[model samples]
Structure formats: structure tokens, C-alpha cells
Target chain A: MTSHHETDIALDPELMAYVDGRLEPAKIAALEARLAHDSDAREAVAKWRHFDNLLNSYGRQADELPHSLKIAALERELASKLKKQHWRAIMLGTGLRRIAAGLVLFVAGWGSHAAYTTGGNMLASASHPYFVAPTLAGHAAFKLAAYQGAEFDGDNITSALDWMSQKMQHKIESPKLERLGYRVESARLIEVDDRPVAVFYYRNAENERVTVSVTPKWTEHGNYALRVVDLDDGVMAYWSSDQLHYTVVANDNRGAITTLAAAVQQ
Target chain B: MGLKSELHEHIGSLRRYALVLTRDPVAADDLVQETLVKAIAKAETFQRGSDLRPWLFRILHNTHISALRREKTRADAAPDLPEPIANDCQHTQLELKQVLSALDQLPEAQRNPIILIALREMSYAEAARSLDVPLGTFMSRLGRGREALRQIVQGVGRGKLSILKRKGDSA
Candidate 1:
């Protein structure tokens, strides 16, 4: 409702209302009559109209979401709600039923962990022989290049973990890498093969660089066991937990990288 | 339709806004998903029969701002200007890119007003309400944002600099 009148030309709120066609017909007529004699106002009106058109055009250019992503999102939401419902149902069961359910859940957890530790590696090698090496190598190389250039959004461990948690939608506990002589430098979110990955960068007193990348477990069939791959200049270790997949890319010290990976897994 | 069912209808609009805010498609999708999840989780708080679009947009805006804060990427973590899309017409594409780059320079406050009013075409009242700012403040921010855009678009070496200069002198 504010109007600025300067040097016989008024930069008024009506200009926007007029451009947006939100004014009453009588007000529009009055504004037009005034604009007829005012060249400056007319020019201002023209610029506002042009900007409006440009914005609408830009909005129209929005890309449609991929069908796969849409479907995945819906499925994820439904599954999450169903999981909550399942837990509630179990909690509300009879006492004997609750005890039986608890026993079943315990057995399931133990059995799965035992199976995972015993045969998970063999199954992964047989089924995904080509999966782990190339993906880990590409991820490692990308993180190395990013680390060498110090491309991170935050410095220190707290903010870095906080950022990782927000982006990945899961809490990321920073491992005791300081014990291994690697200090946290920075962290950022990066994408690899369409999956969101959170990469944390660390440096030591000797200036040795390391990156720990975490993402949700993308493959449903993989176990949380540790796997290591040797690179030309360094080594990379990958593991998963109940909820996440982790990769540690570090300098050529195999012992140091392995220790760091184990610490992260724990 | 039920509230959850109705919520699905706003996904496209939410996605467009998210894309503009994030300037990255992957991030945009993630933002949309997060918004949807939050909306569903907080559905009980939504008043029945109230307008849903603005309410949903408010949630999206809050989610985006919170993420930006956690990441500490932008100072205000206002939506950054997106890069221009690659169109077949080279000239138009370049022009759009220049406009977007100029948009990127505006702070989050000024930028959001322009986006809601100009790009999204929401009424001043509605946009103001969604942004949780008074109408007067929104209008001033929008005015400044438009003026900045005009200066930027005209300064793109397109031979229109004199026009803007004359307008500036007049004002």
C-alpha cells in the first residue's frame, strides 16, 4: 500500500497489482489513464511485466520427477508407517504373546547375525563379484580428489556429523579417528550413482588425508562385514551396519585404515 | 480425499518450489521427500478445512531452511538461484542463465519474496502469510528484488543498460 513519489513519477504498489492483474477494473482504468501521460510509469510497467513473464517461463521449465524416485518415495513412506504399526501391534499383545514375540525376535536377531558373519562374505563374492570393487574404487577416487582440494562445507567433527545426519536422514556417530592420529577437517554430501553419500574428511599431523563416506544401505542383500580393497596410492575399506553403508578411504597405511574401519563399525 | 491423499496432490508444486530453492535436482527430490514425510508425521496438527497448499509450502520452507542451517552452507540458507536449463535456443538459454545468476546474488529474504510473488504467482496476502511476514514487509522486499532483477537483466550487455540508467536517474 506504500507509494514512492519522486520527480513527478510515482513508483507505487499499483504497478505490481496492475502487472499481476489483481486490481479492480475501475482502479485499472484509473491507472491506465494516468499511465497514458506518464512515460516513466509506462516504462516501469513494461519492465515489471517482462520480469513477470520471465519468471512464469522459468517456473514452467520445472522438470518432472522421475517415476522411479516417486515410486521409491511412496514405498519408503508406506513401509515406514507399516513398521510403526507392526511395533505397536506387538507391544499391545497379551503378556504370554509378548513374551513369545520377544523370544522370536531375539532368535531372529541372533540367527541373522550368525548367518551374516558366517556366509555373508561368500554370498557377496559369488553374487556381487563385480559390485564392491569398482564402486568402492570410483567412490574412493572421487573422495581423494575432493579431499586433496579440501572441498568440504564444515570444519571440525561436531558440525560435520550434524550435517551428515541431516542430509542422510540418519544420525552419524563420529568414530575415534583422533585416536588413530587423524583429525577431522571437514565434511560434505556427495552423490555416487544416484545414491546420496555423506563424506567426512580428516587430516593428520603428517598431513595425511582420509575420507569416510556414509550412506544408507542401498543393496538389500549385502552384509555389514568389513571388506578392503587396495588402491594405487592408498587403501579403501567398506562396511555396513544395521542402517548404513560406510567406506573409508585413507593413505597407503593398511593397518591404520583397517583400524579406522573397525572403529567406525563398532 | 483424506488429508494424506490430498497431500499427495501437492507433490508437483512442492517439487518445483524445491528445485528452485535447492538448485540441484537430487537435492530437490530429497527435499520434497523430507517435506512429505514431515507433513504426514505432523498431519494431526493440521487444522481441518484450512488451505493446504500454503501450509504445505510453509513446511517445505522450514524444512529447507533447517537443512541449510545444519549444513551451514549458506549464511541465511535461503534458496540459491538455480543454474539455467539447457535449451536448444542458445541466445534465450544464455539470457536465462544470466538472470538466474543475478538472482543468486540476492539474499535469501529478498529472493524468496520475488520467487513466491513472481515465479509462483501467489497473491501478496497468501505469499506473505506463507513466509510469515507482514504484507508491508513483503511488498518492500518484492520491490527491491524486482529492481535488482531489472538492473541485472538490463546489465547483461544486451544494449539495454541505458534504459535502466535513465530509469535509475529518474527514480
Candidate 2:
């Protein structure tokens, strides 16, 4: 801790500590002795007290500012949000959208683009236990939501994916389903297990919402055949590679999913 | 108290702190609102037994800061001071306004420390952790901030100045 600032003779830290009840016993006696003799030091101490007192008075006065209406409205808004989020959690939706900034919901405007459309089927007929995280299954069971406050580098699909790749610190590119008749809708991040999971939402000709969630870390049973995940709400096809687990949850059916899954693998 | 009420308990403090940071009630409440939405949205991250004020303060601080950075990127970024809602506040204390104006003059780097330690009454260590800065850096800013505020007060010499003039001058 600095004993005194040589550059700036503002409030002495010793006095600051003393007023804050943080001065050491060793320094208190010496500080008091000096305070008895040094009128300038006494003024500095008084100024510190005055500053604190002024702000303290300001705090009390500020309470009279008509904040209740705004705060009540805010509370109501938050309560509504909490109710919705609480229900979403009950419905197995993403319970939390991690980044909390007081800024406007920065909607990054990005034009859509087509990605790879591979015709080959890579379903790996051998089913590998369908081992995915329960949360991923939970995520698939509900509609995938893009974090509304997501800031994207959405000049184009490539840049958006590049940005998300950089944001996630993992190589995330276009899901390459542009040719499969799925245009890039919106891409964003949601927290799972207190970790950021990049989810890309796309819509098909039928306006079916298709989401590809890229969660870090691999599950041993990730290399499974593209089978429709059993969810009462929707159909999902999942696969994984390297350290990334990819799950595509959609309101579409089996045949559409098979093609989508095959195309996603490309 | 339940987590919701516990969070509610800090709303007043959050607003007051927001006012200090932005000097605008609209912006301050917005900061508080965002912090609450975030706190509720991600309540799971907050453990039950740990301190809530620091946790909430971190959210508000980070929220305000990130918002500023994002605003800087925009072509039509707002001015430094937004003609604080307090202007309508017939009860605006001259001394407090001077204090706020002095605080306004400090860079956010310095302003945040003073606001945290002086106004918010956060411990040096807790404030440092909340701002996610090292203790040394936080203390250095506190030292600079204290001096800067002292200078502002001395230079102004406690005179009656229209906040309108101050706003116009800063803007």
C-alpha cells in the first residue's frame, strides 16, 4: 500500500484509512500526532470528510428523485421476464442468456448466404448409443433461441460464423447447409453449464426453425447414426466431431431431418 | 430473504450507483433494469450464501462498461453527458451536482474506483474484484481519482453555476 502519493496531494491515504476505520494501530498514534500540528493535513482530512459527507447527503436527497415509477415499471418488466424465463426453465428451455449489459439489444444486421449442400449420406448406419448431454437433449426438446442481446459481426454469413468462431475461441464456420435449402437465420451464444454454447438458428422453405447447437467437448457416443432424437415436442438429429458436439433440433420431420443431417455433416 | 427479494433489495443501491456512473436517470435505470434482467436470467450462477451486493455490482458495472464500448462503435454515438434527468430535478443539490460534475470529468477508469469506494462504499478489495482489476491498479486509480476530484473542487471554488451551463460546456 502506498504511504503517500508524491505526485498528487489529494486526500492522504493515511487519513482516508483513518476515517474509514482502517488505519493500523502503529500509524494511528503518529497520524494523530501529526494531525495535532499540521493544519494543512487537517484541512485535507476535513476535505475528505466533506467529500464523503456531501455524497452521503446527496444519496439521501437522490432518494427524492421520482424513481419509483420507473423502478416499478422495471420491476414489473423484470417480473414478467422472470416469469417467462422461469416457465422456460420448466419447459427445459435455455434458462439463462449470460451477458447482461445495460445497452440496447444490439441486433446485428447480416444478410443470409447459402452454405455447402452435400448429397452424400453419412448417417454411419452403426448407431453409437445416442450419447449426448442431457442438457443438449433438453435443448433439442424445446425451440432453440438465439440470445437476443447477441452482438454479431454480421456483414455476411461467413463473417458472422467467423465472429462466433472467434467469440467461442473454437473454430466455428458456417454449418454448410445453405445448399440444403436452409438459409442462415441468426447465430448467437447461450450459456450451458456456465459455458457459452454457440447456437445457429436457420429457417427452411417451410419456415421451420432449425437450430444447430455447437457445444464444446466431445461425448464418446457422439459418432452415432443420424437418428431422430426422441422428443415429444420436435425432431432432432445429432452428430459430433473432434471436440465439438453438434445437435440440430427442428420442428421438421424424419425425412427432412435425414437430408438435413446428411447435409450438415458436409 | 429469497433470491428474488434479495435481488430486489439492491435495486435502490443499483439505481443510485447507475446515476453516479451515467449521470442520467434514464440511463441509470436502464443499467439497473439490465442488471436485474441479467441477474434473474442467470440467477443460478449466484450461489445462495455468497455476498449479493458485490455480485450485483459486478453485473451493473460490467453492463455499464460494455454498453459504453458498444456505443463507441456506433456512427451516432451519444455525447459524454446526456443532459441528465436530474436537470428536471428541482431538488438538484448544487454541491452534489458539483461533485457529480467533478466525477464526470474523470475518465471512466478513475471515475469507477471513486464511485465504487467513495459512493457505493465498497471495500477496496471487493471493488477491485468486482471491477476485475488487480488491487494495485484499483488503488492507483483510487489515488488518482481522489486527487482529480480534489482539483476539480478547488478549481471551481464552490460557486453557484447553472448545471445547464455545465451540460452545455461539457457537451
Clash statistics: count for each candidate = 0, 1
Candidate 2 residue spans exceeding 4 A from truth: A1-13, A24-29, A66-266, B1-5, B70-92, B158-171
The CAPRI category of model 1 is incorrect
Clashing pairs in 2: A115-A178
DockQ of 1: 0.09
TM-score between candidate 2 and the true structure: 0.46
Residue-by-residue lDDT tens digits, candidate 2, A111-166: 12212222222233223222334334434443334433253432366776666677
Candidate 1 per-residue C-alpha lDDT over B1-171 given as tens digits, one digit per residue, 9 for 90 to 100: 433454455666676777777766678788888877786686555554466777777888889879977977744334233333333454455555566666777777777777776665467887887788898988877777766676666665254334434555766
Chain B alone: TM-score in each candidate? 0.74, 0.70
In angstroms, how far off is B129's CA in candidate 1? 1.6
Query: What shift in Å separates residue B55 of candidate 1 from its native position after superposition?
Result: 1.3
Candidate 1 Cα misplacement greater than 4 A, ranges: A1-11, A68-266, B1-6, B70-88, B157-171
Q: How much is the lDDT of residue B158 in candidate 2?
A: 38
